[model samples]
Target: MLKHLKEKKDVGFFTSIAGLMNSCSVLDLDAFERTQKAEGLGVGSEGTAGEKNMHDADFTCALFRFLQLLCEGHNLEFQNYLRTQAGNTTTVNVVISTVDYLLRLQESIMDFYWHYSSKEVIDQPGKDNFCRAITVAKQVFNTLTEFIQGPCSLNQQALAHSRLWDAVGGFLFLFAHMQDKLSKNSSQLDLLKELLQLQQEMVIMMLSMLEGNVMNGTIGKQMVDTLVESASNVELILRFFDMFLKLKELTSSSSFQEIDSKNSGWITPKDFQKAMEQQKIYNPDEITFLMSCCEPNMDDLIDYREFTERFHNPAKDIGFNLAVLLTNLSEHMPNDPRLQRFLETASSVLNYFEQFLGRIEIMGEQKEIFADFHSK
Candidate 1:
């Protein structure tokens, strides 16, 4: 441990840390770990302004002093010569400790600043050191990771830090993304649509491990508080309620009233399957249904299999789609204070039939009947 501290090579650092970690002598690290577990302290968001320290400032100061004293005992021959050169070994010790603390502190600073800023926000305090922070943080993580995994390693301790960093980083990025959106001036429909659409894109990019992890806890009560305060200010329920009403009427009147123009809405399941065999180019009618649904990502719904199977939509899937749309639109509507304002305002009703979709599917030569919704 002493040899590595003297040379401070990557291998040496890890060897030293590993040795200490297994033996469990670090008092500050132990307390910090316990605090995180007991408090359920969430991963800090990337978008937050100015950092709250990752460790107690007082504790850190004490730990640094302890480390210096502990390392002072190692490499006596080098220390003696250094003391003679300095006229006092204690003065040399102060300089070395100061340099070591500064170096580690710089790494910590870099990590905090890096991911928060882009090329644009460099002048911003949180963003100014973005690139420098990233570079420094990466180096620290790499060095620390090696140290933690060394033959005398503290692998568990290191793993805990890594996990905490990722959780905090992930939540921060998510926050920064949302802050970018919410801080803008837009209508509720625009904001909700934007957030929903954003989720569709970002959520799928996450690894399954992230989803399975306790990362959910990272969205703390403060986030929920912000959502309630800012997002709830816009009311969209009446628009959605009216939309739902029109959609409820969208089904065939003959089916709804049991009086057909010799027509039934249900196509045979076979013909429906045939239409799905067609490529993603849409006929006009399919476009209209999606527009009416107000599905912002309707263009990207193919992964749901409903894109091709629209003609195959039994009442069951139709019901499911209705539910999803209705639920999505109606959510948070009740939470908005603007609901009363909307109710007091104008009456709106539109019978929507748009087939403006950019994509559609068709089953080849098989003779299959498609639902009327597929027919333009």
Candidate 2:
């Protein structure tokens, strides 16, 4: 049954189903707001205000779960087909509209956080509302992650067409705002964790687009510029930087472990090169540069542990130093989470600046702008 679904002829069938799903999933924001007011805030004395269901959580989740199954697989054939279908039948709108709705709903949930204080006990209805929001958001992000893991070219083109760059910016803003709100309460770890996961997934998706040849030209530069500017918020910048470092560490360690079959903490330079190459993260020159940073022993083996530690340590990173200098963040010690966030934000800002410089083909006006900033 799954095999037949992957066939070219069946693409139209799935595309039509997606289109219908999208049309039916259109959210009535006003009605949604009213429902939240009645159920979450107890705005009206009687329950008559939310008698009509504005959003069907069960139905929506079930529908998306069905689509999620079709998109999930070891291969991307069916997902690609559904995504590439022409005209109104394409699945891109379905994904984008769902994302738009989910982000807005989550924003409302964040607003709901203001109603109760950490010192005060949350009422039954408030508790239920918060739980409901988390469930729906998890479903949306889980389904969307599957939907996005497909051919980069098709996904990148759809990204531009759907104006996802704008959505990405909006999401970053919402994330930062939510983080600020949650920091006050500090009890909603579940929702905060989910947001963190979503942030990482969104960044990974954008990295996929940038890593692919699809976004390597002018449009790519523009998109990168937009993202860099959008991530200017300090909270968002720290989150992105922390996620980036964690991801890099995970991938690099996995690669290193694969090459160190003997479970030793050391490997030859040739093995190091092979492992790095397999990750597809670093270019040849970058790999060579990393290799140069390591001091091989007389046996000519690299200390993988020491090398990784040195790579992750931000003490000497220019961005980290600049951040410390600019923010005067001497109150917290090195291991403090507050100080860590400062370092992460600084590192990400530096990386974004470097990326902006490297991505532009012609120096032109952009170079002068960057140079002016540097000179200042």
Candidate 3:
């Protein structure tokens, strides 16, 4: 929309937006502050990146173009303006700073992605903004990739370019989260299609970037360690979600209540075994699996009530602990090739769990049909 800016004021306006878009976008300041105090570190550890501000799409779009054109056509003027008027002394160079800002914007997009996707119900505006963020992320990454391989001296700006690790790590976690969401069958067809497409784009782009030489000599121990820890958290949290779904279905049956005949809210191991034998809903091996889900007391009683209560609200559990971990560890992790392989393993296992659940559901339906036919 803002094609040409002849006035110095116009240049300043776009610059100000760029800075605003680069500042930290804390969705919950109190929660963030709590985490910072708990961890003894600032939110910068999680890559304090601003979410792409799309309140006025037209204005943001025009600002993006203006900044790009400034870097391309008016490179000298932009650098000169920064030299004299830019308050931020950290602007190393036009290309490096722009790339850094754009990369942080992508980071902001990830922040928004996690926030909305983790919600129980996303409003229409949230969905629209998420889609917009996805589009902006693709553009930003592509531009940054081009800029990295462009005429700029990547070696000189290696520290700034190292932020790509954060960007890549964010997408890896996103890839896992999107896959988990798809398994739940929550989204409508259109949104589902979009998520699937986004996954594909993420895979292709990330794989290409990781395999490329652009990151050569830039990997650091701190970054890789951070990513590894983040991946471990992702694997654990995803497993919790899977466990909650399966346990919820199991506890919904009358078997648990039947076993706790006295309404004591707890059942002994022997009583549980007896109930399973009478119900015949599960085989010996399956019963063993169910027993593993139980929490045992010192008296060897299975705390059915307590166990169910622990995961009664999977979303709430996730929101409190896993969500914070994902948000804090969200920034830079998983750039190492070995970690990528580990993610692939984690993904395959998650898919296998989904398939296993689907089979169980189908078998339950068949059992119900057989019972109805027998009664008829």
Candidate 4:
């Protein structure tokens, strides 16, 4: 079956399904706020009210999107079947339990401390939201997990069905990266252990689902509806995971914190102030990473190899030679008052930048790159 599935079409379709649902989860402005009303997981969302609410809606809505693709539609038809079910206690249990496991992973990142920044958003809007959302989402996930493990009599058969099996497996892979996050002062060994156990259970569950389909009487509309319901929830599970690992830098190492401007990897707050001083305008890539919060990864922005290659290329560096031409302006501008005023302004900026860079060297071990919350 894997071989028969065309890489382009199958991966494309499923991944597109994943992407769209991801958007939906974070799209709704209101539904996301509802999560905050829940207990045990609401902190650090202080000033980000609007941004956080909108972000939550976009993320959860995407989860619902994934659910619809599996079950057919997201409207009354599919939801009704899921809400009905005389004995669906079992199936709901499975979904909730899976979510609980995922929550632990999300919490690890959300609750993590020791975060640093050159800009308010790591200098990246998307990455910042991903970090905050994962924390709240993880708590909700764990709530569902306990729902299943505790008093609920989960529909062992429904959860063990074919489609639900695969959906669950996919989420396991997505959230599994949490093990590699930077987790000092945070005791996450238990979370990591539980995640590995869940991975094993996911495999077992998938087999059970396939076997059930072979022996079952008729799969029925309820079974189909449940498949969609479970799949959608699985997306939520994955979102918490992806947001934690990719954006938040949840790994155990602070390697990203040490990126050097000379190497063009990380941008510190000091990096920003230096640029603001306009010191010889950074290597263009460095400037882009600094201003835009990394077109690539927020945590690790500059790629020295790419920076050096581009800097050395005459075609590319032509854009960077603005300073050199400006130097000529500086040389000839004293002859004319109008041009001289412009020159004065330009030179002031240039001088400030040069001084800023010198200060960084002068103040070694004396001050932090980012003030207030940061300490060297």
Candidate 5:
């Protein structure tokens, strides 16, 4: 029937299939299990001779195949139909809900396989069942990927017009979660390879959308805005770096030469903690977490080179530093009204500038504006 519909190329027939596909939503496994139990159809329940037996695995396989058929042909027509359906909130909800459900199902299967395969003695039947489960889960993932990527594959039209980024983000998050889960089990190397390939493809697609052709300034403007935002908080971050430099000087001085002799420019956690306390900067908890993240091996020493590297390449430790700063700022708010007001005003002004930049970036022929702005 699907092939016939495909061959006929009837709009209504394909639209109906796309609508059905969009209607697919994530299943509530817990509720489903509860209902199954109420109906005397538990996970491993079997019917007597001459009676019909229903299994969750069977139902899952059937659903998987159905979805696979919906996405089998790189069906651009169906994808276009879905793009139209996306205008309806209910349809979008259904699509997202379904994707979420499939991701959860895939995660559950991977978790089960990882757990069972790690055991010393694995049941043959159980392992086979899990292998089949993994296959079904992969099918579910591929079906969704094909559906989302099919339209976006046509240059960047679908990417610009549809909520492709949202879909990409959702799938990326799920894939990351799956990757983490599989990382623990050494047996899932093949799955990990496939996941890495998918991640690379998704990232390339996202870059294509952002960068586009040579004439496109979207990515350049985005980079500029990011730089501006990062610079906005530079003063606070610089103060932290300055404190680090001061501490480095203190620890490297003759007074602490004995301690420095052991690690040759690396300072012990105790010394680092004391320095932070002297600076009255980070709290005890923040200091502890920072020490752990920086050291990571309980080596009892923080490398001076490594510490400075984080400043040069701020991406490495910026999140931790920002989080610590925010926590400290919040703690001091009650006692430091003036500091709070100053921060609030600065944040407001920076936000206004960000909005202004966004508007300027969106304007056509921004070259003249940029040239004029830069000349001033």
Candidate 6:
């Protein structure tokens, strides 16, 4: 059956298979055990003529192979089926558990510290293994986000699911652990940045879920506790701020003066706009939001030092601070080597804090903008 499915080139066939897989009932382990005992079958036993001679391992391999085929050339159909299933409670739960499994497996094989260690002996095969693990991690994360944002949009049940929160926590922890591993590698940095954006989207969906649940008074205390615990990890927060401060250093140097003629240690909105355009990374909405956060005057000038002071303090609108960091990482020029390095490092840091604030805001804690700032 696996070989037949793999050889088939028809899109409809793949779609049908995907739909069937999605709609299938969950595995009945009790029935399977009963059947095994009745048949007196060993792990390698050949079944009767009417029944297929397959063990659990064979079934697992075939299932994965079918999924691989669906993913490889029939992604649209696969995604369509997933979209259809996104709203189903059972399907959402299955996706969450599957993603968690993949993440845990990847984590087991890819040693965060060892992968980045200078003293570790890393050959070509080892590097390939790291690449493969990161790719799997990315796939799992992307799948989770799609379920949250697409099929499961505003799905309170899915959002409140402990497995979903646990998977996200695991993802964030892995990202934090692997930060230093991607430092000197630009390609890996790009991948990391993409992962961060996906993480941000997932957080946004989770927040929407929280809002709905809060209004309905159905938000689980355990979910809230998980979010708060994940958000308040001090080491992660410090690491995030450390990269943020480093990225700020780039703006203080004389290089940016070439772009900002006023050079009054500040850049006006107009100037910032032009720089963003030159970099070909400008987004109007992001620029507007960033300008609002910095509180530019009639002259539209953004004072770097003042902006820094405002953004660095969590007490002053944690959401806005996150928006600033995200905007900076997204809009900064990647072609310029120095700026690219700074942006990549900033991206890694922003990744964690975005998740942090996203989780915290879900609990209704960090949404307000304060007039007075308290230094942390």
Residue 124 accuracy (lDDT) in model 2: 46
- State which candidate, 3 or 6, has the greater TM-score: 3
Clashes of 2: 0
Question: Would you list the C-alpha lDDT of every candidate in the order shown?
Answer: 0.30, 0.50, 0.45, 0.33, 0.42, 0.43
| TM-scores for every candidate against the unseen true structure | 0.20, 0.49, 0.40, 0.24, 0.32, 0.39
The best candidate by TM-score is 2
If the candidates were sorted by their TM-score against the true structure, best first, what order would they fall in?
2, 3, 6, 5, 4, 1
Q: Global lDDT for candidate 4?
A: 0.33
lDDT by residue for model 1 over 1-376, one digit each (tens)?
4344444433433334333323321113233334444444556434323222332344443433444344243333432322222322222322222233334444444344343235323223333223223332333333222222211112222223333333323433433343333322222233323333333222221111111122112222222233334332212322222323333343323232232233433333333323323422333454343343322233332221322232222222222332222222222233444432332321332123122112133232243221112213
Pairwise lDDT winner, candidates 1 and 3: 3
TM-score for candidate 5, residues paired by index: 0.32
TM-score of 6: 0.39
Which candidate model has the greater lDDT, 1 or 5?
5
Predicted candidate 6 versus true structure: per-residue lDDT over 140-241, tens digit per residue? 444444444322323345445546666556655655544434432434544444444444444444443333232213333443344345653424533444
Q: Summing lDDT over every window of 10 consecutive residues in candidate 1, give the lowest-scoring window.
A: 207-216
As for lDDT, the candidate ahead, 3 or 5, is: 3
lDDT of each residue in 1-376, candidate 5, tens digit only: 5345445544564345445544443233344334446445445544321122113545555664665566557665554444344333333322343455555554554444454445543343333433444454455555555555433333244433444434443444444354444433335535544554454444333333332222324333332233233443333333333333344454445655655666566776677666656655456754554454354226866775556443333222332333233222333233444435434534422332232222112222323221101000
After superposition on all C-alphas, the RMSD of every candidate to the true structure, in Å, is: 22.7, 16.6, 16.9, 24.7, 14.0, 18.2
Per-residue lDDT of 1-376 in model 3, one digit per residue for the tens?
Answer: 2233333335555456556556523233234334445445543444222222354444444544554454453243443443233444333333345446545655655665666676655445445555656655555444333333222233224423456556656655765565445433334324544544553443333322322123222333334454575665456445545444445555557766765668887778787667666765456765664565565678998776666555445333332333222211222242456545444534433342332221111122123210000000
- Model 4 weakest 10-residue run by lDDT: 367-376
Tell me which residue pairs clash in candidate 2.
Answer: none
